[model samples]
Target: MKFFNKTGKLAIGSRLRMLTEKITEDAANIYKLYDIELQPKWFPVFYVLSQGEAKIVTDIAKEIGHSHPSVSKIVSEMAKQGLITEKKDKADGRRNMVTLSPKGKMIAEKIKDQYADVNAAIEQLTAQTENDLWKAIEEWEFLLEQKSLLTRVGEQRKNREGSYVQIIDYIPTHREAFKNLNEQWISQWFKMEEADYKALDNPQGYILDKGGYILVALYNNQPVGVCALIKMNDPVYDYELAKMAVSPTAQGKSIGWLLGNAIIEKARSLGAGKIYLESNTILKPAVNLYHKLGFQKVGGRPSPYERSNIQMELIIKSSPFQKTAE
Candidate 1:
């Protein structure tokens, strides 16, 4: 398969962008077919302005759910084309009012029937889907307006779940949590090895006290996922990324990513380079996650555990947060 087509069209954001481009192209074609000399981007402002006597920029922005600066820029372009006019408000001296021009009114009148057919065509196109995307988007947008997606998740966690996950450094009390989570997975898949028991027996002495660090994910004050960064060869200190596990019951909550990134960050805080891990391919999600966090495969590192087959390493860099994630 070619590189771009390899993901089988499963890239949601890319797919959505492709769909948006198609619709935008169709819109442009419809405007051309009707001989309307206007860009699709100009339509919202133009159509909204046509319905009212005059409106201020703030009012138009609020009606369209767009930023004031965005609406202002559009208004500026429309004013340049003599499609709209700006004047001081009679009632409020500080406010500027925007009104459609005579030329714009004539154009609106000329294209009324054409725009009606365009709307009907769009409605027909959308109606073929089982779930109305327009209606789904309206609801999604409303929820987003109430609170951002992450904020809503946090709110739900606080209100409904009653507790949230916190990533914290290894403590004496977290020994059993670190042990049980690791032991459960290891024993279930491949019997717990001697090295597993040694670390689980004394995490602080074996891991934390040896220039290594453990990050544990706690939900409702109980540990859900745990990972440790082990120190090796100083000056160019390499870190062994090992013993990462998320409790099966708490699996799908992204606690593993939290623990994984936290361990990577811990390596950074310790001024280390080349964090590496060994794993079996059976753990597909874990392998994929390592890849996601910039780990590249390097075969045959002589892993201590019998289950080890795949080895990967991460060279640390600055962490950049996604806007919504932040």
Candidate 2:
């Protein structure tokens, strides 16, 4: 406790692990009191099997959010202890289906009463605290999912090493770097359509000459990232933020964030009210970056690209780009 107090937030992982170890120790005693021969670590797999459905290791792992090997290890232990039965799946020969044994079913029935008592005890324990730890943990999980600790630390690292990065207006030399960067990431995930080639082949003719603007991110005088503000003919949005790409060698350095904020500021300077973009949900990191740039999802518009499954827009009139993570 004293070490944790001194270490403060740096000991979060250790603190949470210490709490789990304590709970597990108490749980072992509780299982002994109930006379159930079950391992505390096997409870999740056991509970899943007790629901009356035979599941393969993959399905059990997905449902419980554990790994395939982790669930398989517990299932093997349970089978060895005569608490569960494992058989080859009828639908798939490569998979093994697992279910509770008769002894396991009897223990499951006995555990029902124990489950109720433990729930009541936990409720009483939580009621003694000022805040609900269960709700806090849920929120913490959600926030972590949105932005991981590694990403947060990377942003700080970017700020510290940002002197080498420069955001400047597009130049003729960046044309090839821009197209190649976009093509590299696109081909890895989705095919580049005709629209991509038209712009990537000639940014000046397809975008800039049409009243659009492009920005390039240079790391140590070498172009590594690019973003385009395509002038849109739509009434609601003034520009379509498109052709954003960062080289694989330059990723995780917050180049995307810097380029995105620079583009938003460029849009504002051009008197733009709103900006629109199309993206696929499978590009999770890109979508998360757009969300960080204050983009909100919208619908009812057809896309020019087959890979576009989701659409997002950002109102730039009132929303000033704030580098929140940095």
Per TM-score, the best of the predicted structures is 2
RMSD of 2: 9.2
TM-scores of all candidate predictions against the true structure: 0.50, 0.55
**Residue-level error in angstroms, candidate 1, position 60:** 44
How does model 1 score by TM-score?
A: 0.50
How well does model 2 score by local distance difference test? 0.92
Best by lDDT: 2
lDDT of 2 by residue, 1-326 (tens): 89998999988999999999999999999999999899899999999999999999999999999999999899989999999998899988888889999999999999998999999999999999999999999999899999998888777787876767899999898899999999999999989999999999999999999999999999988999999999999979899999999989988778899999999999987778899999899999999999999999998497789989999999986444443422
In model 2, pairs of residues that clash are none
lDDT of each: 0.83, 0.92
- Model 1, 1-326: lDDT tens digits are 36448876456467778779988998899889988767788888898988857999999999987899999999999888888989999899999999999888878888898978977987997888789888888898898888886786665664544236789988898888888899898888899888888889988888878888888898878888899888776443388899999988886676777778788878876657678788899989989988988889886765678988888878876445522344
